[model samples]
Target: MTPYENVTFKERLHEEAAKLKEMSFRDKFWYIWEYYKFPIIGVVIAVFLVGSIGSAMYNNRFDTALSCAVLNSRYDSEALTVDQYFDEGFRAFIGLDENTKIDVDYSMSPSFDESAMNEYSYAELAKLTAMISSKGLDVMIGRPDVIDHYGEMDGFLNLEEALPADLYEQVKDYLYPVTNAETGQESFCGIRIGDTSFGEKTGLILEDPVLTIMSNSPHTDTAIQLIRYIFEQ
Candidate 1:
């Protein structure tokens, strides 16, 4: 047969080349490249910038969230816990220490005194002593205690459910404290960070006392700054 009838390689190649010019993926790509290069580049750059900024912002936000929580607690002068970082923020809302605290307990059906514990746990006595001395009170328990007390914040009450009805109203402003172990009575009353007083009578609770207790009270702006520092990245 003639070379033309047999379809020579060169002839087949030429035929394919012509068909590609008319209908090929490469040809279609050229049209797209010529028309949309600028718009495509712009979209890519915008997406990269947005993703980078978003990642940076997310990192910064976590740093701020942790810091604010810590600072708020320090402003109140309360001790913090490992788990506290993840908890609801209650640091600056009250006393320097978290109000969710409980005093040691020693119950005695027949009025038993805890003489042994006194030697080991004089911390409570020390606190009371310091509170009295700072207040310029008689420096004695129950002698120079809160007389005309009260809080000013509108939503500061902590009337926990376990309390007796009469005691509930009495200690609601105490800020969610646990009952004293020995007395079995609630003692979370007032913002007594050795100074920040609160109660139901004065309407202006913490003005006078904090000045004495703070000596530069942790209840001040300085304390809050420390909180910020400790909680930051």
Candidate 2:
């Protein structure tokens, strides 16, 4: 007889469920939640776990995306932003201070004496290498030039023929030679990055000694993942 009777049974059931939900919010929310405590707890825990994992996955994705962006354009402002973000995210994983500085400097010789030249003019790439390695950057650099001297370096120099043998022997290595620890090894190949001018019009050329940091932060897992990404691309 009523309008409800005109509607189908399914519609009536849905309507009833909606009414129950509204009532539960007003009068029975606590009771209903407690009634299914186990299921509710399970859902709460599941949500938390999923959210944590999702955040980590998102950071990883962001790192990969930002790295690609950096490779194409180093000077892009976006690259700097993304790199900062990635560094912040990774910093969360690494136990380090908020103000930790990652100073990078390139030198013609890893053994360059700070006392001889402008100490501040150059960032100690060798020191950086030592820190990275000590921290177990987990990534190993194949070339001695790639890292700071882990031990003393001993080898032949072509310049010996041009200069006095005695002077050459004393000066071939820097006053503060970047030496190896276990095996005496010194850098062989290096690029002068400082004191250079790319443009003809530029009066003074100042190109700092160029240093190559082959990998990002020395996280082996991160490095492997990058290799995979590169191959796939």
RMSD of 2: 21.3
What 10-residue stretch in candidate 2 is worst by lDDT?
Answer: 65-74
- Candidate 1 lowest-lDDT run of ten: 65-74
Model 1, residue 152: what's the lDDT?
18
* Candidate 2 C-alpha error for residue 187, in Å: 15
Highest TM-score against the true fold, candidate:
2
lDDT per residue (tens digit) for residues 35-103 in model 2: 666676566555544554564455444322111111101223332333332345433444446654322
lDDT of 2 at 226: 30
Model 1, range 108-142, lDDT digits (tens) per residue?
A: 11111355433213333333333233321211101
RMSD of each: 26.5, 21.3
Cα deviation of 109 in candidate 2 (Å)? 13
TM per candidate:
0.19, 0.24
Residue 161 of model 2 has an lDDT of 35
